[model samples]
Target chain A: MKEQDDKQIIIHVDNLVKKFGDFEANKDLCFDVYKGEIFGFLGANGAGKTTAIKILSGLSSPTSGIVEVAGFDVYKNADDIKRNIGYMSQKFSLYEDLTVKENIRFYGGIYGMRAKLIKERTHELLSRLEMTDYADKLIAEIPLGWKQKLAFSVAVLHRPKIVFLDEPTGGVDPITRRQFWDLIYEAVEDGITVFVTTHYMDEAEYCHRVSIMVDGRIAALDTPDGLKQQYGAGSMNDVFLKLARA
Target chain B: MNRFFAFVKKEFLHIFRDYRTMIILFGMPIAQLLIFGFVISNEIRDAHIAILDHSKDEHTQKITEKLVSSGYFILSDELKNENEIDACFRAGNAKLALVFEPGFGRLLEKTGKANLQIIADASDPNSAEMLSNYTQAIISAYIKDLNMAGYGNKIIRAETRMQFNPGLKGVFMFVPGTMALILMLISAMMTSITIAREKETGTMEVLLISPLRPIQIILGKVAPYLLLSFINAIVILALGFFVFGLPIRGSLILLLAESMLFILMALSLGILISTVAKSQQVAMFISMFALLLPTMLLSGFIFPIENMPVILQYLSAIMPPRWFIVIIKNIMLKGTGFLFVWKETLILTLMAIAFVVVSVKKFKLRLE
Candidate 1:
């Protein structure tokens, strides 16, 4: 039970400071993503969500921080973090030239999946998502909704403990976005912690817990209901607008 | 092994699907070879020449016939006098004027010597020099033949046989050089563009975020080009032998192994370029200027590296294509064995190792 409980703190970011030259992008920021929860990290365009995500993704080194993901430190155990986490970007980041199955296999292959398992998982995945019909189609030929689902599935195909989604629903239709949230909910239900950064307040409401970044620090961090009730607002959208304007 | 094969299969599918890549890889190199071979030449043929004969004797008439038959010079006009030489040149009707001094046959018979002053246009020195040299050599040979026929007692003799490339076809030189260039372009430039394209389309991030090892990602990206360049090497060799009449005088296995080594070196260079480049455009620009330009210009493909300035010569020496050109030329044109080409092979092997090391280091740094 203790071993499994240790997995609860899937990601624990401490007093993280990221700087580009003299400018501090993420300063004295701290947050934690519990296991099996959809945690929304929200910020405006320049509010430093990307910089923090970059540091966590092992794409860039943090200026100073104790960044941990999937029970491994970001600085020292990056290889472990790599194995333990998956990322989906704002771009529906599947290989357009590749067929849906090939993209899944490619992603799975990268994570060192066995050929048999990759093939098996691909079959299971396509059938589950009802993407079996589009499995042989090139990613470009598929509809946008299917591409979005494929990108999300590919990100988590390796069965990582946590998935980092950097605006995974950008340019996606509202119907697909809602469907996308259902997929996230399904992953979380399977004990895969979801750490997502988004500009959408409605999406923020769907997250079990949400943190809003304003100017480089976490301005608000709580449940959607807790934040709205505390801020005397009826919705997450109003709470965000009031805080952003402030 | 299966994973590697699967990765290679995916790479081939990517290449086969992209029509532009198929054209650039299979279509361009052969076209380039044929275009440069049959369409262009360094040998000057039928260059304009004006004749000035003081004595229009049988000897001079026979000499003109030999010169005309040699195809080195076209007799543009008969020069009336020495004064007309300048006018003929000024009128741009001739690039060279031959002046046969007065008493040409008389002097040759009595004094055993005759002067043929060839005043050639010095603007393009190489072609002019070749023209003059051909004229002199042909005239000397004709005189020698005349002497052997008992017309004269001069015993100066010369015999020549063109060794490997008897017909002296341009394809003999260009075949190996084109193979070097095309393989390098496909392996280095095209591979970099493909890798950099993943970064451009935002797919690289997703792949990296997945469970795929960085090594597998790189191997997957480069494997297709490796197979392609190898097949291209074979195609060029077959075309050179069957179509263009070039021969492989040395061990075929050694040539193929060395060609494969050179391809690896080029692909490593492509990987190195992709590491520094942020997007496909940057990758392509770097591959063109940093790899393709050096591979083509510095490798002695079109220009002799020996004739370049000392610094450029040294720079060219470091280029893998330079070593590859020497190796392939030795194998194909010179028909030299492995003993002769092992040093070049070693150089290419070391270069491939160095490129892979630097690129892997850069890739690690980028991830950091």
Candidate 2:
């Protein structure tokens, strides 16, 4: 993994709370993601990880909190934050009926990228993924692994400052998951911050820092080694169990 | 503008590449037009009938001849008695039976009133109702002719004149109504489904996370549908004019302008539906039950609104297509100008604005 010692904070959240009626989906959340660092948002099912990500990405609003993304207020400057961030959802986000090139071009164009730049990036992305032959192929014809990778590439086509990946490797093989992480490492190398959510502990260990949510609050927030040492556990899975059990 | 076009192009790809959507968007209107124009018409011609005459007198014979010669009915058989009436109907040889009462001519001469029983097969109530109506009209005309023969004074003659549609062609009624239905389905249902599909596949989140404004996203999604539905309206009008000889008696430009207005209204309705639906299936169900069925049933498309119960008539007044069909009929059939249809146009404009405002508000709420 590339070193992320710049210490420039990109995302700042303080005491964020989101409630639906009487039920709180996220409660008293506080975290910060640094410049060019891979911040893993780890949680079990219904752990409010998705809810926190939504608030940070400007997809939803918090009931009460101070949340800043890419140096802009989530409440007042959501559009500016949107322009500076990329999002790849857990569900496949590409138009399955559209060709791979069309999908990339559409995302690039919507981000106000010039036509010439979109063409250049299209060439570079397809070549980087070794998918030059599959540019004209419909997304539905591609394998799930390549599709997720392509989705990630499309998400970052405009080179946003930060990218949010919500469970980008949910149902992929081990090799593909590793390859997806390699892409994240490459993006981080380019000084693009990554805020990703996952339940995979092996993937959690790859992050510079991790925050594990239990119920609707962040139960633990630290580096993987720090968390494991603090809990006297061998792996992130056990650390999560020890924290969650407590 | 470039981003908007790019988004719209993506939408077009989603539409044209999917054969199911293509069939529904293009093929359904033509099929509905052909079916409604030729097969499911209300103009009765050569309907089968059985006659049971207890009085073989001149008056009863004259009435039967008048009914058959009016070209609305053909005598399939002559029944012997009341028992044969049910047999004739059960055999499906006739949809209607005319029974002349005993001493019908004598009763008419003495009391100036005669009795005849017309029994219609009521299984399919709409057709049965039409059959009974046509039979009554024919019998009434015969009675009028009999009075004109100087046997008695003619009582209260009504010189009814049917303007525009002198032949009362069923095509005239269906063309306007079908246009309303087709435009609403293509604009509202298709746009809603496309948007809901994006939501289903999670591309909607990607969209919301983009720099494009929510209004831009919505307009981008519906712009292609607007163009295609406009083309569909023109095609339906051309077919109605050329194939069925339906007329555009008013200004063609005004007709098109009104159609565009209705399409806008329907697209706004689509946006509203998409706001409430989270999945493609749910969107489709809501569109079908909420928009499509109401546009068809309560829009005065096939049924006469004035003849419906007063409560339903009041309900139909709020149906957007009801006003749209009336405006289209006035422009295409009645040859009326803007003065006659301005109220309908204003109503449709208000509805379009209302839908757009509601959907935009709901969409902003969704984003928050």
Candidate 3:
């Protein structure tokens, strides 16, 4: 329950390679994510962060590598991995027709949450997001920022060991983005591992540890300050541009 | 199983929550049935006809009166001359015209013969053909009646009445078939498209990553549509029975059980389609192409499969509609017991099982 007490290795990947025919979307990728920490997995588009995250989330298979998340083998224990991990894609996957409560209840049902518990938790989730009044409102009526936050909350509603947020802050307002990070901070405080990918350099500075991918490979992996100092850059964006150019 | 139920619940929410899909799945069936059943019957209804009786004799009067009272034709006008027949028809005054030669009543007494000409406008061939056929029947009946009166020994009688549909109304045939086709397309095609839509939009990935098993997810997604389609089937059947006077002379229990079986088969097809397509558009195109046209053309619902080409007949044998239509005809028209329909039921059950099995396998492969 204490801060940094759940600092266990939540994700462990070694030499992970995801190849489609002759093209390798993720080649020889390696990383480790610690519990109770927001780990930034940054890369330009097509730099294999998505493929690696998919493999880690048990959504896809690695070509020939050892990938483990929460001690469940990516290939052998996929269902176990799916059970232990939650994913919120960049697309904000939520049923548009169903009400906010219905969406939560349906996803909760997927997580095998008991009806009474889903009810209690759904109520708590709405109140926590200040979305209690809108529980009856269909998701289509909600703003994109609130929907994004709701999607993230619902993703981790069952309290998975690790949560994967694939560009969860795309196109959101600056104030809402800040609020979204606060929600992520709260999740991290509860000892949940947060694996997030984003183009926002300011958000990367908030991560405990960060890895920048370049050209289907992990180009650099270190703390924010160390990355900035090593790359001799003013910010993570400069570090990225420098690394991407070199 | 639990996960599938949840996904099915989600599916139901998606289906019921969207008014468009509800209208398509449910509204279309009842609308199609009513349109096909009540509106589009080939039976003549208060059809107007002009009579060109040049002689104005007692026999022509009696026959024309009989024709008007037959309920199939209404005498719109009594023309004075043959020239008026074509002009009245050209003016669209009547679909048919009856012209009797001079002295029709006197000819029966003298030579026991008379010339009665039934002239119908050929512009619309369907009504013309039907008019000619009915006119021929009325003339034959009159001759037979005259013979019976003259000879007093009624050798042969023709007191013909159409069985099931006493008026031989075409709506009686269309209602059941329309319901079957609409339900099949909506339940199977729309559900499949919705399922495939989730996959395309990356929402399926979100569900797959959850604690829910793949089967649970699919079952959950399809469950609501199944229930909705069932409700649709009931509404249409009720409308057909109550509104259109279409009878279900067979066991109601058997008909319901058969309908449920058909719903399952159609839902399985939706599942199969979802597995094949990755987007709503592709799923829709496939469902429209695969189910709708085939259900209409090859099902023996409108066009008899027996009259189709040998290759088409063989193709129809594999169509679920063909079996469904047979079952409906047996129940609605023949009023037969379940024993007679067991073979078609077995085929539908097998098709349902095959689709469910194939969809399950395809779904599993996607997970793998």
- Restricted to chain B, the TM-score per model reads 0.91, 0.87, 0.92
On DockQ, who's better, 2 or 3?
A: 2
- DockQ (model 1, Cα): 0.50
User: Tens-digit lDDT track for model 3 on B3-42?
Assistant: 5677776776676667888788767877788788767778
lDDT of 3: 0.84
Interface RMSD of each: 2.4, 0.8, 1.7
Candidate order, DockQ descending: 2, 3, 1
- lDDT string for model 1 (B219-254, tens) is 888888888889988988888888877778788998
DockQ of each: 0.50, 0.76, 0.64
For model 2 the local lDDT of residue B211 reads 91
Instruction: Give candidate 3 misplaced runs (Cα > 4 Å).
Output: A1-7, B1-8, B151-164
Residue pairs in clash, model 3: B3-B216, B4-B216, B4-B220, B7-B220, B7-B221, B8-B220, B8-B221
In model 2 chain B, where is the ten-residue run with the lowest total lDDT?
B153-162
Alpha carbon deviation, residue B365, candidate 3 (Å): 3.9
Predicted chain B of candidate 1, TM-score versus the true chain B: 0.91
* Candidate 1 vs 3: which has more DockQ: 3
